[model samples]
Target: MDTYTTTIAVASIVTSGITISIGVIGPALSEGRSVATALSSLAQQPDASTTITRTLFVGLAMIESLAIYCFVVSMILIFANPFWNHAIA
Candidate 1:
């Protein structure tokens, strides 16, 4: 409710938004590249489709985890904001 709290809230929201965007964009691009590469490899080597598919799944999982983490951080900013309490106190 005070100026400090207002500033913290605004900063937290901005930072969380930026972090979410960066986190999502990077992983999205990485996932897309991974899939494209995997598909290309699979096309070139039909016999290695199983291995490529397995690796592609692993890469996708890792990339997705980053986005999930960002989502958690954004949710924390919007709902369970620690900075608000810290600023008030």
Candidate 2:
């Protein structure tokens, strides 16, 4: 393959790798920390368990969206990259 093609391929691979690592690791850490906090709160105030649990779910969803966004961006970069056409031409 031409240099342009090789370069694009290498770039895409690197981008995907970085995306996966950051996307997975960051969310995992955030979710773990959030759960730990929620559990601690629930233990301290058992009466507020319902509210705490509800809020925890919402926060977790929001945090997870970041990972989802990262996944989408990586997929776009790998499969539907705007630069691919330019490089090929």
Candidate 3:
């Protein structure tokens, strides 16, 4: 591989890793906190367990999408990076 390609490859790998690391940390912490809060709410209001659970699931899904988007971006950078084209060309 040419120096350009090598540089692109290294940068892409590093960027993708950083993206996942930062992306996951936020969602993971938020998910844990949200779950804890939901549990407390349910405990205090057992009659609203269904509503709380439903809301929790929806919130979790939305939070999880952030991680998913990061994963997809990382995958793109690793496998189908547009930069590679310019580097090789």
For model 1, what is the error of residue 50's alpha carbon versus the real structure, in angstroms, after optimal superposition? Answer: 1.3
Clashes of each: 0, 0, 0
TM-score of each: 0.88, 0.93, 0.98
Query: Lowest lDDT 10-mer window, candidate 1?
Result: 80-89
lDDT string, candidate 3, 1-89, tens digits: 59998899999999999999999999999999999999999999999999999999999999999999999999999999999878877
- Candidate 1 Cα errors over 4 Å, as ranges: none
Candidate topping lDDT? 3
Tell me the tens digit of each residue's lDDT in model 2 across 16-79. Answer: 9899888989999999999999999999999999999999999999999999999999999899
Model 3: lDDT of residue 28 = 100
Give Cα distance to truth, residue 62, candidate 2, Å. Answer: 0.5
User: Judged by lDDT against the true structure, how good is candidate 2?
Assistant: 0.93
Give the RMSD in angstroms, all C-alphas superposed, for model 1. 1.4
In terms of lDDT, the poorest run of 10 residues in model 3 is 80-89
Model 2: C-alpha RMSD to truth?
A: 1.2
Tell me the tens digit of each residue's lDDT in model 1 across 1-89: 58898898888889889989988999989988999999899989999988999988988998899999999999898888876777877
**Clashing pairs for predicted structure model 1, backbone only:** none
Error of 3 at 65 (Å): 0.2
Between prediction 1 and prediction 3, the one with superior TM-score is: 3
